[model samples]
Target: MFPQSPSIASASNVDILIVDDEPTNLRVLSTIVRSYGYQVRQAISGIVALRAVQIQPPDLILLDIMMPEMDGYRVCEQLKFNSETKDIPIIFLSSLVSGMDKAKAFQLGGADYITKPFQVEEVLVRIDYQLTLRTLQIQLQQKNNRLREQNERLKQEIEIRQQTEVELRRSEAQLQGRTQQLQQALDELKLAQTQLAQSEKMSSLGQIAAGIAHEINNPIGFIYGNLDYASEYMEALINIINLYNKYYPQPHPEIAKRIQVSELDFVLKDFPKVLKSMLVGAERIRDIVLSMRYFSGYDQAYAQQEDIHIGLDSTLIILQSRIKEQTNRVAIEVKKEYGEIPPVNCYSGRLNQVFMNLLSNAIDAIEEKLEVVEEPFHPIIKICTQLSNSSKQFQDKNTQWVEIRIADNGIGIAPQIQRSIFDPFFTTKPVGKGTGLGLFISYSIIVEQHNGQLQCNSEVGKGTEILIRLPIEVPQSLDVSTTRKVKIAPSSLSLESDIGEM
Candidate 1:
């Protein structure tokens, strides 16, 4: 076993080149290196050594400084300068035992230097030391190269993660915006569906009411016309009975007995009253039919000149049942301040719907208030209409307008929610009681269709006042006088008596 070999397995197949001018020295070094289980090549000169290294590079080299043609210093310089051979360990074997020469050998990239007649033990020790050092350096370099590759991969991964995070944030923002858009669209769709349902229902109701009114008008007209003649005939018959009694005062007892049994006196006294009551009843029926026909307005196909007062009255007549006295509250009072406004050109049916929605809401508010308020709270709706020749709201100075204000003495809307009252599907009423499309449709009919304005003024505890301003469409031939204010005194419209018949 070699004394300086790290292991027999490590020394296997290790190639070394020995160069000198002396054949004996080359043989000796080669033999010694080969005995340590290393493959050796011999060169008698430095030139031969360079050629052998160029042909097939070795792991280690042992060179003599005193070679011919090319010295060990020159060979070492040539090997160290080459990129492929620079890492090979070089040892200097020389007879010159000077410190300067050793220094010179090391400066020329020599690994170790040995004197002439050196011990084999020293030669092997130096070779083993240099080989072990180079092996450790190679392993460290390999580890450094692996660490650098890992760091590069980690850097790339970090970059990819950062990009992914940025994309995720962008996607989240887009999703949020899209969600809001979808929600808005869904709300709009709901509002539209409810409004369509309400419109269809109202249209059907109008048709039914118009049909009923038409059917009743014929019979009521006939009964109303004949009632007067029947009353006159009854009067004549009573006169004949009286005259016959005067002429036949001395009649048979059987005739007088029959008269007494028939209660002729009571008939004579009550016959006229019964006819009068029938006449009154027939008249009331006629009035009700007329009111129903007017309120239905299903036959009105186009915009025409209409009296706003009549529209309001027709809507009130239709809603009279709701305004009637409840168990907890008295009948609601309506105060009208009608101005001398001319007939307005408008869609009477749609205008009536607007009035209906507003008054209905007013009644609902009053009823809601009645729930919490004590007695003595007389709920009232104040309606005021005014005509103006010129207004700042009108773009044309000469144009005229009709302004209406409907106010109530009930629990008012909060200020924060007032602005949204006209928005579709916005309501404070209980679920089944309100569809929330009343005000929204009313707003559309007034502002969008009629080119008018609808605004609300309210306080939380006091009440709400909704003002409507519409431009009056004056006809060519119709004469409208100067604006004059007409006020109707406040009156209680108690529908308690009328609701039963309705």
Candidate 2:
């Protein structure tokens, strides 16, 4: 049967020791402590209690203040001094009834003190209280030790992680540097490839242009040379016929009839006009051949000082067929506002290629506008050029720059894709219409090779303007370097290629 104490200590098996001098008192306390579900041991004196406690400490101790040789205070002091048994809760059960005696007991680390003639309820309650407190202290100490151990392990792990992070960061930095170097090499390789392809294509075009010019110039030269002689011979024959009519008015009826049948008077009047028209046609052909040679620039392969307007005019002449009236749209009107800019030192052929590309794009833009819009619209491309300075276009004052602007009234580019227009293989034109390398190559030629700038400004319904600024005297040994950064204006346009223009 359990003690009816109704205390927390009764739930667990607890060890308790009762120390007293009286055998009867020890027996009585032992029964009560045992009934409370505690394992009780008895020591008849303080000395025996201390010995028993040293052997195996109990959860709590009930010590008596009056005992032979060693009193409760001395025993508690001894127990409190020992590190192993200091935490054991001690309750004093004594016959001494003085205030000093209870005070001394408490001073020596006694948890509770009870006088003689103690009620069983009071003694058991004190014992239960001390035991419960001892159990709580042990649990708290255990938790504290575990927490300390976990804290030490966490600190070690954190140190290891920090060292690993340092090494990883060092490796990452090395890898990033290597990646950047590799990327730079790749870009240079791609640039070289593009330049080679461009050179081959330009060479082929120059060869074709020169061949055609040679083929046509020979026949056209012969026809042009004979036209004048033919005209003079016709005049001499007419004079002889007039003289014959004057000297011999009476002609054979057969000759006069033949003359009447052939409409001689009308032929005589229109013959000079025919010669003049033919002469004009021959002259036009000669001019076209000259323009083709000039545009091809096969002879001027290297950088040289040349009139930019000449190249512009030559490109326009070559593109005359495209600018002519189309089935869907009227002839595109080319408005040239050329300034009195001096000859610019450049690769004339390359510059001409750029001009051809830009002009062809303008025509395409106009064609696109015509296809989508139903309203009557006259397509126009405006080409403007002038000398600019640092204040004008943010160039060096010492170096004069020529600015060329090619504008077209067409379906302008949307704002969102404006930044990507210069990227390689990017295009807005339908599959077969564009090759997407025109603007990219043009950008590379102008910015990288010639050290020039290309800029675009546009509005959706209004128009697009492409501006090119180049130094009048380019570097003598200009090497194609890295691509320059371009700052696009607020609104811009996309570009497509006419690879056939070359």
Top candidate (TM-score): 2
Backbone clashes in each candidate structure, one number apiece? 0, 0
Q: Highest lDDT: give the candidate number.
A: 2
Q: Tell me how far the alpha carbon of residue 193 in candidate 1 is from the true structure, in angstroms, after superposition.
A: 4.2
Which residue pairs in model 2 clash with each other?
Answer: none
In order, the Cα lDDT scores of the candidates are: 0.78, 0.80
Question: lDDT by residue for model 2 over 1-502, one digit each (tens)?
Answer: 3333332445345778899999999998898778767788899998899999989998888888888788888899999999999988898887788898888888888899888789888877777667667767777888899999999999899999999999899999999989998998787677666656766687788888878988999999999999999999989988888899899987899999988998988888888899999999999999889888887784354689989899999899899999998785689988888999999889888888889889988888888888888788878888888887652445367867888888888887778877877776678889988766678778877777787888777667666788888887777877544444333332242333111111
Candidate 1 colliding pairs = none
> Model 1, stretches more than 4 Å misplaced?
1-8, 17-32, 41-57, 61-123, 141-193, 220-291, 294-309, 339-351, 386-403, 415-427, 440-454, 469-502
Candidate 2 root-mean-square deviation in Å: 7.9
lDDT of 1 by residue, 387-454 (tens): 87665534567777787778887787876677668766778988998877788787777766566667
